[model samples]
Target: MADIARRPFLRHLRAETTSYVQHLRNGEVRHAGAGIAFWFRPATAALAEVPLDDREQTLLFHARTADFQDVTVQATVSVRAVEPALAATRIDFGIDPRTGRWRAAPLEVLGGLLTELAQQPALDLLATLGMAEALARGLAPVRDRIAEALAADPRLAERGLAVTDVRVVAIRTDPEVERALQTETRERVQQEADRATYERRAVAVERERAIAENELANQIELARR
Candidate 1:
């Protein structure tokens, strides 16, 4: 990442293969592309570097379900700059001439953008479903819904960003709610187990009665003989 060296009034810039470097001199593009190096005067040149590699951002947020149940959503969104030139224009990917580092946090800006874009659809979808339904069918549906929303949003295209993948890691309620649900499930399982045990005992008793009756009939036959 140390791709810049300070020269006497000039700076030497080297770009990585994963980064798209744009060199602007007096409001015109002098050089642009990935993995290209150039020297420019510090006073007159503006440099912008946009990373083209895919990045995964972890997102955690809260949403309310249709039944007014509050749940936390954890997700990961994979994204990349599809058009580096346009991205450089949209976001402040500009780097200081002295250091090959961004003057501002461009990636953070992208993260905020992605978080908003991903959260809205999830909120809307969860709002339409109850907590049970959301927990039961939320993972795939939420992931797909977010993917669809990101893919269809024109803002991303205009900003030269694209969503590569979306994954819903977890949708969980509060600890108290979670414990209550767990208790309910556990009780249901215990009831089923008890029923099964009772049925097994009943079958054993019936089998024993049939065996005893058969033995008695055999003894009576012997007595008659």
Candidate 2:
């Protein structure tokens, strides 16, 4: 009876040791707090879904990272998961896990997306009527390319993973560009004002000339009478 009791304890210890070894091998052990999946929209942020089995608990992680920087800007995203397991794999590898299921694919896709985003002209980003719409428009080509690439990846297609949104969270303009735009606007306004004033003065002068000619004609008629 004592041996049986001791066996359970010994087995538990062995399991713990094995888990620790696996953790060390994995480099970082992501406790399954909540299984998360990511859905990256073509022109918006990445949406993370949690509870790999259920679509409801999915959380979106709006990821925005600046060019040439290691830091990422993340917001709480709102999206649903089409493939829970795939989404979970994306979150684990893309955000936290060093060696996750989609490790290579996520990095490749995200890196390409970020690089393409960075290459976009600042003016294009600012000149658009709506930031989100503009970003979506801009990302059309990139999205097509990404889709093709993902289709080529057997693993991603098998999981039914898709990127849904990719949008501009915020736009940053150069100070010089802003100042130049302001100056141009002011100059244009001043030009319009000057033109209006000149037109008014010309009209006044023309009216005065017409009145003077009428007066002269009346004087001539009176003198002749």
Tens digit of per-residue lDDT, candidate 2, span 11-59: 1111121111111113333222232222222122222223222121111
> Which regions of candidate 1 are displaced past 4 Å?
none
- Provide the clashing-pair count of each candidate structure: 0, 20
Q: What does each candidate score in C-alpha RMSD?
A: 1.6, 14.0
Q: lDDT by residue for model 1 over 57-143, one digit each (tens)?
A: 888999999999999999999999999999999999999888778999998898899899889999999999999888877899999
Clash count in backbone of candidate 1: 0
| lDDT agreement with native, every candidate | 0.92, 0.36
